[model samples]
Target: MKRPELVCPAGTPAALRTAVDAGADAVYCGFQNATNARNFPGLNFTPAEMEQGVAYAHARGAKVLLAVNSFPTAGRFDLWREAVDAGARFGVDALIVADIGVAAYAAEAHPDLRLHLSVQAAASSPEAIRYYVREFGVRRVVLPRILTVSEIKDVKKEIPCEIETFIFGNHGLMVEGRCSLTNYVTGLSTNMDGVCSPAAQVHYDKEADGSVATRLGDFTIDRFGAGEQAGYPTICKGRYHAAGREDAYYAFEEPISLNLATLLPQLMAAGVEAFKIEGRQRSRAYVRQVVGAFRGAVDQVLAGEDPELADLVALTEGQKQTQGAAGSKKWR
Candidate 1:
């Protein structure tokens, strides 16, 4: 089987170094602005930090993929433009972008720099994938976390660019780049602002009945019992009351994570060029552990040994995980 590139996340310069040392083939991060999707407070790097991150990764024989993945607004197009330029200036190995306008600018101005389609583009079909490749010279495309392994193989056969998929981390079932719940509540657009359910609007409070209520912008989304684990309060994962049901339940997606380490061999054989881990806002320890574990697992797969999986249950949100749609035909 062909070994795939192990792409990991780096929220900070420290996480970049940690991921590289943990044996990541490439690390993807964004600038601390609205240009990238994971633009959470206190995360991502500045231009100088990105330059240093590139140097750190390159010195260790690893590559840095800058995530200028967020869509720019009409008048603020310059933020995205400057981001594409910064990638070229910092000597980043590739730019992971979702906006066609940004991609066009990159292709026109910095044709030498590599381009990877972000999952935000939702280019599952071969025709859609080829459009980006044909229009923008995109070299790779990050597949949405909704395709089965067989489906991915089928798409790979018809597409020219390389395929990358999430092997671990957030398994949010919302169509990438399409959710607007955060904007409706807090007026923060996930696409244009690169933040969803901004931390400033999140609140956790102890309720009167010994339950913990999770609120987003003064609206309580869910209440956890005394012993139950409270999930991160994103609109998709929050529970809601319904007329038919006596109890409240998750309306859209449940709080769960994706763990596909068991399918490493199948993914490699399916023409997947890269495996991506998807937590850019997590802690440095989380980066080190997940990257290290996946590194060992991928190496073992290449060596034809049992990938003695490390116990990663403690790191996942709400201690819950699923194989997602990669193994099953059913969507949910």
Candidate 2:
């Protein structure tokens, strides 16, 4: 069995180094600007930082993938162009891109550069994957987390390029590059602006009854009771009043994270070429603990032993996790 490469996240230079030292086969991150997803404050790297990060990861026998993954809006095309140029300049192992224009630019402008299709493009089938491979020379496709292991195996059989997938991180439920819940409420596009629930528009208030109300701009996204855990203020994960329901419930999606630790062997059997760990906006401590744990898990799996992964659940979002659509075909 071919061992899948362990791709970890690097929100900052320190996080990059931490992930590498903690057994990351490759570290992926974005620039400080709004060109890539996870464009949060005090995160991402500067040009000099990216150069240093790439050098750091390369020196330690690890690779660095730069994420210039967000779509470019009209008249803002140069921002994405400059990001691709920067990736080539810094010598990133691959550029993960979503926009077709950006992918074409990378292919033409830097013929020697490697291109990996981003999940934001959501190209799930063999036909879709082939189109990107033929048109843009995409060396790998980050399959949407919405696929079952059986589905992934089927897709791999027909596709020509490598299949990379999110083994851990954001519940792949939200249609990548298609989510507009944030835009509808905040007047900012997560796909275009590279932000979901931008911090500038988020507000929290404790109700007199002791429940806390989390609001994104004018809309109250969710309210948690005194004993309940308050999750992130994103609109998709919030509770809402359904038309026929008497009370509030998770109208869109719940606060569960994507955790495929238990399915490592199945994923490898499904022909996943690479396993990506999400969370570039997380702390260096998070990188060390989670990456180290998963590193151990991958090593054991590669050695033909059962991977021990229960310890990593402490880091899951809202202390909750799910296999998403990877394990079960009937998963909603």
Judging by TM-score against the true structure, name the best candidate. Answer: 1
Query: lDDT tens string, model 2, 1-332?
Result: 89788999999899999999999999999998879888898889999999999999999999999999898988999999999999999899999999999999999999899999998998998999999999999999999888889899999999989999898876735787799999899898888888989999998898888999998999988999987865667898899988999999988778777888888898898899999999997889888998998899988999999888747666777777888888776555
In model 2, residue pairs whose N, Cα or C atoms come closer than 3 Å (at least 3 residues apart or on different chains), thus clashing, are none
Give the range where candidate 1 is weakest over 10 consecutive residues by summed lDDT. Answer: 323-332
Give lDDT tens digits, candidate 1, residues 32-116: 9999999999999999999999999999999999999999988999989998898999999999999999999999999999999
TM-score of 1: 0.98
Residue runs of model 2 more than 4 Å from their true location after superposition: none
Error of 1 at 114 (Å): 0.6
Residue 131 CA displacement from its true place in model 1, Å: 0.5
Candidate that would win on lDDT:
1
Error of 1 at 241 (Å): 0.9
